[model samples]
Target: MTPEGKALSNIVILGFGFMLMFTAFQTCGNIEQTVIKSLNNFTASGYTSMSIIYGVFSASNLVAPSVVAVVGPQLSMFFSGLLYSAYIAMFIQPRVWSFYTASVLVGFGAAVLWTAQGNVLAINSTDTTIGRNSGIFWALLQFSLFFGNLYIYLAWQGHDHISEKDRQTVFISLTVISLIGCFLFFLIRKPDPSEPTPSETSEAPLHTESTDSASVSGPPRRSLCTQALDAFVKACKLSVTKEMMLLCLPIMYTGLELTFYSGVYGTCIGAMTRFGHNAKGLIGISGILIGVGEILGGGVFGILNNNRLGRNPVVLLGLLIHYLAFYLIFLNIAPDAPQAPEEGTDLQAYMTPNVGVALFCSFLLGLGDSCFNTQLLSIIGFLYKEDSAPAFAVFKFIQSIMAAIAFSYSNVLQLPWQLLLLVVTGFMGTLSFFMAEWGVVAKRRDSDYDSI
Candidate 1:
């Protein structure tokens, strides 16, 4: 096959593998708070576990570049997948010790997995194709939300609460599915360094210095600790740049919104008793709609990009849609919905909860999220193709920290206050993103003038 064809094939394989693993994990994650609460009636256990995962994920991003540099992206992904599998398997028994311990491990795994993922995607793409490739991968990865939720809806149909036998069976099946996905990492062929990058002609390459020796023959033996320290320093330097500093606000917003839409909103849907006994199952339906919205957003923004369009407009559009979503969520759902289950008479929402409106809001949340992520991926890929690993690590680091903060407060804040925070952050993030994009454009224009 041609090199171009081979590159596309690798991208597909990577996307599919993630779809399988996350389909299992995301589905489990959507209900983690509710499930844990059901088991022990402690509201904080599930949120606490999620907080730990993102907290560790935030710290681990510092080392992810070093790990990916030494192991290569392919191997890094495989090992990270193992960590994901172990975490998912912990749901079978759901012990505090085992669950929290697994959470910490998976947090580290998630950092490596995402940083390596960015490296592989960056290497496979070119100046113009990065947007399209990011779109394809995101669209494919989000399929997990649809398939996993569909399974939950079916397996959990007619039952208000999950039974022990059924819960065990569900988790076991998901574990096997995740393992199958991990095996696909072995099939990926690393990108050849000879491939062209946007940085080759216009600027100095940003590839991590230590990994320069990685070649077809094999990487040279070096002290693992030394390589790690060097990579960490590189990441820190990149993080302080004006461009990176500007982008941090938007990056952090993505993490906060991710937790809101994926975990908090779904839990709110599950806690509503006004819809009757089967209300909890609405979480599954909401997941399906979210997947659909995300796919549509990815297709429009990621896959269908042209020179006429740009990242800033897409981000602004996301901000508007999120405002609409927050408005609906604020009015339609009660402040206390996420706190505990609410009966028909006990409910005190601004407007009575309607399944249709709630589901529509879910769709909007997913669509807005897609807009932010695909654009961020495209922006980072275009601007830092040479330093892809550490650049992505910085993005993930900020994002995970914000996510940890959001999860930490998920149990404490009411729905209205949470919505307020998201609204304000969305506005600030979009403005900051616009500033960053403008700076990039201005810098490029100056470079072109210099060449003249």
Candidate 2:
């Protein structure tokens, strides 16, 4: 590819690759959650199994940077998708052991997938367009929720159970889609050797200081295990910085919210709604509502661009909106159970009246989520530039740990406690943005931002 063509192709490749992965990943993930619920997870309302998924996902990220370094981005992504497919296969026969095992495996793929994806996007996109591009990428990825959820709605419409034949076919289709993503990933051209990574670029904050300029000149001879451990320790030390820690807080809350959406929120939906596919199908629809919110939020942010509107204000607003959405969900939607049946009560009508409000709440959840998350990602990718790989790794590591905790407590915790998570976490997350003095530049590092 020509220089211009190759750059454009990079954009197209990421868009296409992520489209494939997101489609397969969300569909299968939703299916797995549905299948698990149907089987009756008497063990902590199935939150334990979900926690295992996030926990393993957290552990896998410890080596994700190393995997990305050794295998390169394309191969790392391919293997990541493959692992996701393996985890999806577990849905066919959901058991406690198998389900938890699959969760662990899925976490493995998630670490690699996200780590590589963030770096690829950061390298390929410019600071000027990073905000818009992040928004676009988020919109495209979330779009999968729309299609995947729609499929679930159709497949299990009006029924609380899926037939064996349908189940097999659905899973097989997801696996195939994942395979397609791998192929598309393989088509992506390598990052141009001419491009400077964040570490080489002056824009990135200092990560590791040079002790002796000429002492360490080449790649270390240590194994991947040693490299990962060294990376972990470095990340921990760096995490203590005001900017890093501040960023980590909100990012960690992002994980908490993600856990809630992935496990707790859906579980709550099942509890409140008594219709169609053990409320699994309904949760799928909720996914679509969230997609709508993300798309709209992304559109607005993409239009504004972080440099012009100032990233912090937008993020703070998003935090407020997010907290409001969850508060509404806690108050009007979550605790209200399906009303007792009257004579000849329509089974389908159970809690149907409240669904509109619930769907609205779901949209706000996505909007608020997309709003802050998009900015955080764009800012981090822009400020850290080439150092994005490890920067994001630390972000993901902290985020996943918090998410695991939230999921672990999902069933055991009371509604008030859950709301406290939203309240306090949201407050701290919003506050973290103030603590961070990020350099928001349109193209190059602005003179004013030299302080960052």
Candidate 3:
């Protein structure tokens, strides 16, 4: 093919690959929320089941990047899509084992997709455009999620009046979306030529004088085990750089805050349902807010990052907004005195606080999360070269692990003080702001070193 043709083809492939990744990611989010609603319909414990699924999925994310490195991104993505399809098929059965098994598969698939997609983007773009490309890629993924949720909501509309068969049909429709995504995967080509092979460019050189350093250091030590060990050590060393470490803190905080709110939202819905409230409506509303928040945040961040507004200030503002939202959520949960004569037996009184608080919190969290996420990407782009994929993948894995732990604990404790989680989340967000600010400064220092 001509050079122009090849370049065009590569871009097309990247776009398709991105779409596939988004479809997979959004599908995972959709499934998580749907599982809760599905369990409620089956009269099963929604929180316990959802928590288990999330925890397992989060843990799976930790190893997924390594798996992709071993297997190659294209195959990894293909397998992930297949796994997702299988999981959705099993969900149609509705047994506990089916749900649990499917959850594991979904988690595994999501991890694979995330890692592979990051690798693809890292390989394809230059450092200058990585931030812009990353922003657009992530925004598209969020949009996919927004639409996925809308699809599910519409599918299950009028649930109160629908029959069991109709509910089943709704789920089946949602599952089919994944199958469609799998077919789309075939259209995606391999990594772009501009990007290095994973093996060739696995490690960033210690300094700008990479050739001299390699010559002095001599040939890389032989043995797969030795190489792997060396890679891990190097990764660890790289990760601890003042800039990288600072960056990781905010990423971690972002992960924790996002996970905590997710748990709180789920728990709130559960609490309201137990009290015989309009659980379905509440969940639907929360879903809408999350979808909207992701889109709004993604868009706003994209614009701000591209403009002269520096990354640090934008992230700080996002955190402040997030903090306030958490506070509002806390107040919503504060118990109001009994009103009616049958106050003790009244479900509405018990349910009102939970639902109202959830609605307000969801909107604010959504908006703040978007802004925070965008800024985080920009910072990562600023610190590293185009090969930031593995680093980004590793950071995501860490976040997922933390999220898994929190989710598992939430399930086990069955904490009634769900709002309290928000307090911890707020504190984490504040810490993250400082960490991000430090990261920006540290990154500038590193850039100076590179320029020399």
Task: Decide which is better by lDDT, 1 or 2.
Answer: 1
TM-score of each: 0.93, 0.83, 0.75
Error of 1 at 146 (Å): 0.5
**What are the clash counts of all predictions, listed in order?**
2, 3, 0
Candidate 1's error at 35, in angstroms? 1.3
Off by over 4 Å in 2: 1-5, 40-45, 194-234, 273-280, 334-353, 438-446, 449-452
Residues 1-452, candidate 2: write the lDDT tens digits: 55435644765677677777777776665455445444544232345666776787788777776666545566677778887777666666555676677778878888888877776667666766677778777777777667777777677666555566777777777777767877787666544446644332531212111112134453454654565565555556555755677787788788888876655554455445433333555767777887788878877886566545577777787888887877666665434222111111133321343666766877888888887778777777766665666667777878888888887776567555676777788888877765673523333456657767
lDDT of the structure predicted as candidate 1: 0.83
Any residue pairs clashing in model 3, and if so which? none
Instruction: Kindly indicate the candidate among 2 and 3 with the higher TM-score.
Output: 2
Tens digit per residue, CA lDDT, model 3, 242-318: 76665666666666666655544533443343334344434455656775777677666766676655676767777
Per lDDT, the best of the predicted structures is 1
Write the residue-wise lDDT of candidate 1 on 54-85 in tens digits: 99999999999888867767778888999989
| C-alpha lDDT values of all predictions | 0.83, 0.65, 0.55
Candidate 2 to truth, TM: 0.83
